[model samples]
Target: MTSADLHTALLRPAVLQILRAAGFGHARPVVIDTATDLAARYFLLLASSTAQNAFNTHNTFVPTIQDVRLALTQAGALVPQMSTAEEGLRDAVEIEGVMVPFEDLRGVQGFVTWAQGPVNKEIRRIAGFGDDANVEEIAAGLDEQEDYLTALKKKHSKTGEESRYQGTILGKDTELQTVSIIGGPAASIAEWTQQSLSTAQTATLPDADEPATPATSGISSAPLTPIESE
Candidate 1:
């Protein structure tokens, strides 16, 4: 089997688990494959966008939480933003003797709502995250402040990732050396573009005392000269 097929096969079980947690008792193999592929692509897009944002804004490929948030926002993953001006206009404008209130127009953000729901809690529990229920207080509902995934990861691998995933595709025995593209000076395309633009600007800059020439050559003194007799 191809590498991609093997990767998809590995992801199918996780996707099936999520679906089962979400109340799907049985799903066709095709449906599971489609879901796994979609999930993989979505995550890949998020990672790429987050890395690009980090590199462009901070000059580093390492992404922070804020970079991931921005990437999610750009990808429309964090939806149902505050009502737009157009929606507010609906409050003032009337159609068929009915005016829709801005509050009525507003909808709950699906991502946020899903994250805070029971399904997410169940998923977390299935993934070995600590239960949100407080054993001390039986009456208390699920606590939103718990760091379950972190706790689970720490429990599994207290030392580090290198030890946990040693000799696997997810980890390496030796650190990778930095490599650049052939005939390329910078490590990344973004850095290369910035370097090229800076060099071009420096080369084309006029003397500090001299006024910079206009970019357009079509507009000349001849155009402004008044006709003598014609």
Candidate 2:
């Protein structure tokens, strides 16, 4: 979704209460939108991984609650780790009368409620009440074309002296010639593929005890023999 959609979803009254708790109540419009984007991105990863994890464990396409739990636990490990999201979803909810992970995807131990609480509650809370917060007053629409990207831009354009690459990265005396917020050089990297593929395809692997023999037009040099009838 666009930043505006995420901002609106996140600013819902229920989510607002949570965000308020997390220091978003009086936060600036940009800051709040940014946090919402981060959260939305994180949960997207969580949902995908969780669903995939469930199906993977069962060796079936249909995801079970146990899969949900296992996936949540595993995906949650990447909150600030291997995950792309800044904060990952929580893993392994404590059952009322069971020792943490109950393994079986049956009964009330289902992760439906566990997965369906807090954030979900707050999200649905806005819909249930029909009193979603008016984020228009919070700030201008985050969905404006190219607005957010421009906001994040910090140009230091000047044809002048420069510093070492490491020094520039560390914000030393000289300014950066350029820096990409999104990613690194793609065209250059794509060009780096090895040309040795031809050699590998054409080169003949000789028997350890025999001298090398090159093939002509990929045909074997073994002599043709007459077919023998059984």
Q: Pick the lDDT winner.
A: 1
Show where candidate 2 strays beyond 4 Å: 1-14, 21-24, 77-230
lDDT tens readout by residue for model 2, 74-108? 65531222231322343545678554522333323
Task: Give the TM-score of each candidate.
Answer: 0.45, 0.31
lDDT of 1 by residue, 63-98 (tens): 997687778767877655443455576546566899
Residue 214's lDDT within candidate 2 is 60
Which one is best on TM-score?
1
Q: Show model 1 residue runs off by greater than 4 Å.
A: 1-3, 82-113, 133-166, 170-230
Can you list the residue pairs that collide in candidate 1? none
Clashing pairs in 2: 54-67, 79-88
Overall lDDT per candidate, in order of appearance: 0.69, 0.48
lDDT of 2 at 92: 44
